[model samples]
Target: MKDDIVLSVVLYSYLDRPIFDVMLNGSGIGGANSYGGNGMITGIRVPFGKQALTWRLDGPPGMARNGETVAMKNPINLAAEQIPADAHYLAVNIYPDNTVEFVFDKYIPDRTPRGDQIIDKSERHGE
Candidate 1:
């Protein structure tokens, strides 16, 4: 497992609809909840190399109610040289325009640049 890296992912959205599915390397890890602008966080073990992260959202141009959804994928290179020594977390913010921002951090961030919508998964679910 030496070639594997543990990744903590925080997924959220500023779109009208929440991202219901978040995937890494095309595999589902979790999703971003829209309720109160809250987000969902999950951790996964992936290889230490080039990776692809994708998410599914429902709204505009597309219609969730009509069984239509929009999905976006972004490349995430997990090479050792790319990750900082102290930053071990990955946080993603999905925007209304089907864009996303990826951030690396040493600790899980309290909230995204927007506001107090994100809470630890454990704290949110009382686990």
Candidate 2:
């Protein structure tokens, strides 16, 4: 559907953070963690013109370190021109400092022609 927005999630952090659930509007969509260095989630469908995009982050089940489970709730405002006109995909990047970066991309395929053709050249005459 043209009104559907494709979303993805990425995690970037130096600390070995516990895996956390990614909730959209109070429902779990996927999980992300920094333990594996970097993680990515592709192909999340979000209907356009939604009231709000809420993210509910919670530590994994039964794996809370120090008896403290990480829990955070935030909302992404869609009415603030968060998305660009040329953007067709959205990415949410989370950092250890709880900083979130929303990236808008066109998701265009890399079509730069590869250097595969061999060129023939003669040896330098003055060599």
Give the winner by TM-score: 1
Write one digit per residue (lDDT tens) for candidate 2, span 1-127: 2655656544332223444455544444455443222344567665555433333343556644523434333445554355666765555544444444455667732211110110011122311
lDDT for model 1, on a 0 to 1 scale?
0.58
The true-versus-predicted C-alpha distance at residue 90 of model 1, in Å, is 1.4
Over 22-107, each residue of candidate 1 has an lDDT whose tens digit, in order, gives 66666566655552233434566667876666665544565545333555544556676666678767766666555556667788
Find the candidate with the highest lDDT and give its number: 1
lDDT for each of the candidates? 0.58, 0.43
Candidate 1: residue 17 lDDT (0-100): 56
Q: In model 2, which range of ten residues has the least summed lDDT?
A: 113-122
